[model samples]
Target chain A: MLIEAAHKPHERLGAYLKDEMAAVNALISQRMASKNAPRIPEVTAHLVDAGGKRLRPMLTLAAAKLCGYRGPYHIHLAATVEFIHTATLLHDDVVDESGQRRGRPTANLLWDNKSSVLVGDYLFSRSFQLMVETGNLRVLDILANASATIAEGEVLQLTAAQDLATDEAIYLQVVRGKTAALFSAATEVGGVIAGAGEAQVKALFGYGDALGVSFQIVDDLLDFTGGDAIGKNIGDDFRERKLTLPLIKAIAKADAEERAFWTRTIEKGRQQDGDLDHALALMHQHGALEDTRADAMVWADKAKAALAVLPDDPIRDMLHDIADYVVARIS
Target chain B: MLIEAAHKPHERLGAYLKDEMAAVNALISQRMASKNAPRIPEVTAHLVDAGGKRLRPMLTLAAAKLCGYRGPYHIHLAATVEFIHTATLLHDDVVDESGQRRGRPTANLLWDNKSSVLVGDYLFSRSFQLMVETGNLRVLDILANASATIAEGEVLQLTAAQDLATDEAIYLQVVRGKTAALFSAATEVGGVIAGAGEAQVKALFGYGDALGVSFQIVDDLLDFTGGDAIGKNIGDDFRERKLTLPLIKAIAKADAEERAFWTRTIEKGRQQDGDLDHALALMHQHGALEDTRADAMVWADKAKAALAVLPDDPIRDMLHDIADYVVARIS
Candidate 1:
């Protein structure tokens, strides 16, 4: 496991697709430039230049290349996906009132929320312009629907915040909104743009959807167990009262006293210093973390299984490896 | 002017297009709903229900109908325009740090800036979905370009704020971003969806663009003169340090002492009680407001002249009146 961790599947994928990824980076820099508003580029460069792992755009390039896409528009689609992701991150920081991201001061902190909001809108518009340049209405439709899903999921998550009634269904919905919709769209558009068969497109979409769900589940779990791996302190989600997978699972199993504790800490935002440890203990008592990990493994497996209908290629193997790597983080 | 103001041309346009506008409203209300995110509807309804002039959507409907379009998609186009307008307004309130809009507490104030930003994005995505329903790439292209222009104009406005160097050219660019881009997009998409001739579409775009410029010039002029008619206090722009047309024109003609006052009051934002009056006096002394009015008249005339290429319909006449009525607000 240690040897495997030294060179992750995603890193391997990135190295394999290095040339294509560079094109996406070039396109992102080119499109993010605002000829008049220097601040637009400034704010964008602050975030886009931040080490975002480029996982989402890599998913696009991989999906297209895996499906034998040879056109220039995979670059366009890859850049479009990154813009949407970056734009969302900008707004998410403002929405979450975050101070730092990826070990750097957030654009909202360095600049202000106003610049973040306006620049985010600019990037989204630029994404729209990029997609429209493809002139593929079906691609447009898939992306448009995905955009709506993402926004709806965000709104759903906001309204559900701190409500003890948030269950697995709501958790899944929020998960999809926060991550999966874009992943699925990134892959689906790649296949559609490549003129792949409907079955292959569906497989790609399914692969991305399950992979995103698994990725986020691992993120949530790592918040409790992986210490510094999640990029911050353990129990940040607990402090923020996000009812992610493990918490929801544990809460579903809570007894009367345990329910009271959750209500006090999460529902009322009255988190005490030792509360995270207590929550972790309760999750263990209920095996909630184990259950959540189990669920994530299932999703990772589903993601791998979804790719079975696609062509046999090294890109396909890397995508399969990415799915395996997602669950492997928490394994 | 008093006789003409008894029933505004916009009111006439609304009356003539009432049924179609009703359809637009219904579509807006229906699409603004979220199955999962109730806050979206809450924030949207707050601004969407605020007694906005509904002028932008009406431009779309009028343009399409005047071009002899009888399809149901015009309703979609009109609703798309409104969603874009509402979304921009929500973000604008956040950007301006505004407390109230149209005498109602803004969405950002009523709920929070987080909800405002997310809901605004939801509405934007919703607008994209609605435009895609038309299955017209040209319409999408026009709206996408306009969206970019609007965001760019806004970023430009942000960077240009309180800078005495902002000229009439920059002011016009900002005006186009803040108001005219959407206006022109609203009209242009309407014509495009109707499959109108290129000449007619160009005329429609020209009309909306000029009218929006005229409307905003009147709005800026009113901020200096029309106490409360703009739904806020006079000199609000002055207090906000916005360099509108009148201010830009007056700044160019400022004497040494007047430049000091302008610098201290606007650039430094160190306005005293009598600063607004001094600013107004300076504007009058230089005929700044008069020149701005002259500029508004030219755009209004241009708006009217653009309609000359269109078929002679009552909708066109009312559109012409809407232009005349805009300048009449300040004349």
Candidate 2:
């Protein structure tokens, strides 16, 4: 394999679509700037500059390119997706009252929650304006529907947290909203904007949806698996009392003694030291980690399979590899 | 005057559009609900049931009726405007950390800020979905731009507060964002969806814009005028350090000692028991309240003037009446 191709799937895709990605970056900067509220650009530039691989925008660019798109509006749509993503992060930080994100202080921490909330609203408006500039009613419809689903999912997650009754179905719904809604919309709109056939759009949507699910599942697994490379401390989820898939599975199969332990720690949120070891042991004994990993593999496979109907280009190949790489880190 | 015409303009318009307003209310209740997140509806219900004038949604119905529209989408657009307004209220409560709105506890106060933020987001998305269903890109464009303006105006308000330098222009911008943008969008979309002529749509926009600014300026004047009838305590704005038109005018004409007093109380926020009374006295001494009330009249007249191009129906007459009633409370 060529050395260039051996880099991570996103990196390779980033290298291949360097110019388009650069255009996306430029559009993000230009759009995030405000003529009136300097606080807007101040808060946004902090998050935008903290850079989370630009994965969502790249998904938009890659999907558009895969369908032979050469339009300028893809850049707008790409930036639009990023703005929505950034807006969500700002609000999420405020909702979580998080102090750090991507190894830096969160916007909510740097400014007050008021700035975070108001700036998030401004970014959402900016994203709406950008997508409207495309003048594609279909694109607008897709994004509008996705936004509802995403927000609904956030609310679901907020209510579902630390609840023992939350099942796998609720978990899937939350994952789709909090993570996958924008991902699927990001890619699906790219194909639609390119005037691709309905089948191609469906395939793009499937690819993005599956990839997003797999990405989130792997992320959840890493919280238990101890993601030192990613700098996420182990048991952070346990300490936060979040009900991830593995914990859900473990809770489902807990014996009376284990049930009491889960109740005190997960439900009651009275976590103690060394409880992390016991939780990990329970997850391992229940095969929750293995099942979650298997679930991730299944989704990654589904993502790769969805690409078969699309045009077979280098971008397509990168997209295919992206599925494997999304699961590869956990392996 | 007819008995109905003698009623408050909003109530008169509400009675006139009773059937359509019922439909709009039904749509709002239906859409604010969440199938998965019970918290969304729970929080939304607390606010939606608060029973404000529903003046914003009424504008949509009246504008559409005046334009001779008979479509089902007017109901949808009316509901959309209300959702956007409600969403703003939710977020505004969070930003203001306000305990009460429209004489009831705010959602952020009843629930937490997290619920306020997320539920507000859900409403915004639901509003987006409702508008997209209209299938009118022009309507979408108008609303999208309005959302951005409203949000940007909010950020401007956040930074402009407690600062003596916030001029009338800045106050107008903030008022437009927080109040006028949605009002104008509500009317403009109503006209556009009704297939009204461009001139009529422009007039509707102008009317909503001027009426909103007038309405807000009058609200500011009432704060210092001791609006006991409205249940708002005198000097609420003074305590909040909000740079309303009267405050801005007073600050603009302050002497050196008066400037020092403003710098101490308003900017430094070291307010005491007599500060509000003193603030009112200064406003009165400087003729700030009179000038502010005069400014409100100017905008209200402008709102009434913009109706010349529209059809001279009862709805049109009510809209004209509304511009007066908005300032009538202070007078």
Candidate 3:
């Protein structure tokens, strides 16, 4: 399955799309600047320079290159996607009161929530400006809808994150909104910009959607079993009372006593010193972790399968591997 | 000026553009809904339903009507402007840690900052969707730039709000960004959509820019002397340590003792009894309040003068009156 590889899929894709990514990075730096507001550039550079893998923008570039088109607008669209992502991350840190991101102190921590919120807003507006410069209404439509979906998904999560009634269906909807919407939009806009056929564009959207879902499930899973390699504190989501896949699955299969335990710890927000360990034990007892991993694998497979309609390009191979690598962390 | 009459200028414009304003209100209600996240609508409705005069959207409608625009997209643009304003207000409340707005409890205070931030983001995305539906690139560019400027202004205010070094020039730049940018965009887009000539569009932009500057100057003045008709607490800006136009003027004219008082109260954040009254006395001592009012009158005159290039229509007259009424609040 080529899943035994030691190197990262994104790094390989980054290498392949190095030139386009370099253009995207330059555009990002250029657009993030404000002639009047120096604070905008300051706050933005702190997050943009923090050195996360530029995966989303790369997805856009990969889709464009794979679609057999050469154009300048792809760089604009790639920068747009990255700007949207950075904006969302800045706002997300404020929403979650997160102190750290990508192994560094968050922008909200370094500058203040006001800076984070306002700078995030500036980036969102700047992204719109970049997308509008493409002069493609379809791309704008896809991105605008994806953005609305992303915000809606966030608000949905705000309400449903701790509710026990949030089943797999609601969780999937939330995941699609917050994470998958932008991912799918990134790929779909790239194909649309390249004047790809309807079938290929749809395929790109499908691939990104499935990959995003797989990506988020794995993220949630790693919050439990990721140890130090994930760069997030283990059980951080548990402490936040988030209804991730494993915990939801465990709760679904809980017996009376286990149900009481879940209700007390999660719903009531009454956690003791060893509650996280006990929650892990319960997830193991219910095989919830394995079931969650299986679900991520299914989504990853679907992501790979969606690429069958696209042309057989090297970029496509990397995209396929990216899907596998997203879930391979759980293996 | 016709603004000397009993009725307010905005009320007159509202009556003039009543039908178009109705459509904008309906569209706003329709677009603000989140089919999945009920919380979004709840938070949005709290702010939308609060009777805040809806002046920005009215400006768009007035500009379009003055340009003889009969198309439906003007309504869309008006609603777009309103949604953008509401979104910014929501975020501003969260950034300011504000407890009340427009004589009502703020969305942040009522729902929570998380809801305010997310809902604000949702509305911003929705505004983009609405503007994109118009299929006008120029409109998109103006609105997008305005949005970026608004955020930049807010961030600038975050840093400059309390600093004694903030001068009249920086204050004007900040005002042009936060307030005048939107006002000019609202009017410029209307002219662009209505097929107004380049001269007319530029004139509309100039008029809105001047009127907005005057409007904001009067608002700053009212924060000190407003007898409760302004729907905000007197000295609220002072309490928040905002370096408004009046305060900037007073700071400019401060002597040794007055400079020490300004430093102690504003820069050092040490407020004691009678500080508000003492600050007002100093402003009076320097004739800063009168000078600020004179500056507002000059801008309002400039706004009226800019309208001289446009068609001599009733809507144009109303806009001229709006410029007068904005400063008349201080009279």
Candidate 4:
């Protein structure tokens, strides 16, 4: 029901969000336009213009309005969240040695790793400065914790990657750290800076966290069972040897032959040309992709459940729709 | 006169400091010891155990007592300062791609760059958690500003390195950002959390800033004139193509041939063996090292002047001696 309303009535919500986010974007462009360092703007704009969905900032704005926030600090807090997100992306590309991001050459690849690392540090410093301008110690506490969690999640993922023993519990931790932490913090701080009550704040945080977890699970599952080649490639995780939910489930369900195949391809990270087809077949045989999708829908339902405490509003319906869109790509 | 106190009868500040710093070190060691991740302690303690005077934490302790602080937060602040310092060093080594740090293999070399970067992030997060536990917003502001300044300083240093046109002003900016920002913040927070008056906090910041400036100048000067490998390698800055004080000062006073030598060797990073002697001779010929020493003394005197507002105490006298010790190697 929420999904149907979101699809039909969300155009108005989108328009309102576009204007709200434009202000945040304008502030970011203004702050990022460093006169002293010409190279900073050049590199920072390269990543900023790469066009993320601006989901985090939008969450901040949405949560702020939902809680009856009347102050202007939410805009600043939203911008702060966006900066931290961008800074982490810059650093993440370098850490992951990722050559392409958003289907464009990453800053690390286009420039040098040195510039990426240093400029990321500059953005981080700038983000903190922006947060300080808000004069909210609670906001700082939230953002700082989010940053630490993001970093810990990254370290955990790094260690967990390629390890055969990584189970769903560790997988969940990594996904939460890598994705949910920022999402929850973004929405949580929106409520906090708005001076929302504890229940509203906690509701918003739960909504963001469940939505984040669902989003990541869908992304992971889409790598296996995406209906179209344009939507998701087959066995991207296998080639990278990333132990995602589908693969972990398949491994648990694998017979001797399938186990041997995974041991050769996944553990060794030496997949052959036809390995993608073989992996997909194995996943289908075990119904692992379907299971992962079910898990994601469960989280989406949990996300929708979190809004029970909030007053009925169009933005709340849009939030539910966004969670559906996250899983709809799998269909 | 403060330099002479090193040889004269006085309070046992160094021995007393050793005991105080031991407590700080114990706290750092305890925090760094990760149960699930043994690599955390291994990498952190490697650098923590590497011998340095723990000068930053010592400044925090000394400044706290000088401002009549008797609280337990000083210990936390001291440990927080050191954690920040160590985190920066870990990242700096990765950025510089340096092999040796304080005569030991760098964290990057010892445990790989990924480990160094992630572990550095861990320490940064730990430092934030420690400061948050203090529950002092002012102290948090002081430290968060310092973190930004430190990162910015590193970026400035990176940009300024290898640019021969970098002047004394730029060099001072780099030095202030990279080295002195933390020093001032460390002491400023010490006085602040101790509930010192505004004037006292300002004085403490001034003391730390001056001492930091003198300390960096002495470090630069020692790279040119320190004998017997007792100091870091002569012209290590030159080898790295870093535009340190002596090099910038020498360039200012250089004749055409000397300038050409710098352009080819330092700027181009094309120095061969025996260039160290030639470079040292050029420094002497232009009185660049001597000029740098003059700058150090100016900062030292300024540091002593900062103590003028403080009540006369043995700690104040010892503070003066410490500033003197920073440049003592050059003398």
Candidate 4 per-residue lDDT over residues B158-237, each given as its tens digit? 77788889999988888888799999998898889889899889999999999899988888887777652642676778
Q: Each model's C-alpha lDDT?
A: 0.91, 0.90, 0.91, 0.81
Q: How well does model 3 score by local distance difference test?
A: 0.91
> After TM-score superposition, what is the CA distance of residue A66 in candidate 4 from its true location, in Å?
0.5
Q: Chain B, model 4, TM-score against the native? A: 0.93
- In candidate 1, stretches whose alpha carbon ends up further than 4 angstroms from where it belongs are A1-3, A228-230, B1-3, B227-230
Q: Where does model 4 sit among the CAPRI classes? A: acceptable
Better of 1 and 3 by DockQ: 1
Per-residue accuracy of model 4 over A171-266 as CA lDDT, tens digit each: 998898789998999989988988989998899999999999998998888777655454235666788888999989988888888888888887
Give the fraction of true interface contacts kept by model 3. Answer: 0.81
- Whichever of 2 and 4 has more DockQ, that candidate is 2
Clashes of each: 0, 0, 0, 0
Whichever of 2 and 3 has more lDDT, that candidate is 3
lDDT of 2 at A184: 97
lDDT of 4: 0.81
- How accurate locally is residue A10 in candidate 3, as Cα lDDT from 0 to 100? 84
Q: Cα RMSD for candidate 3?
A: 1.3
The worst-scoring run of ten residues by lDDT in candidate 4 chain A lies at: A1-10
**What is each model's TM-score for chain A?**
0.97, 0.97, 0.97, 0.93
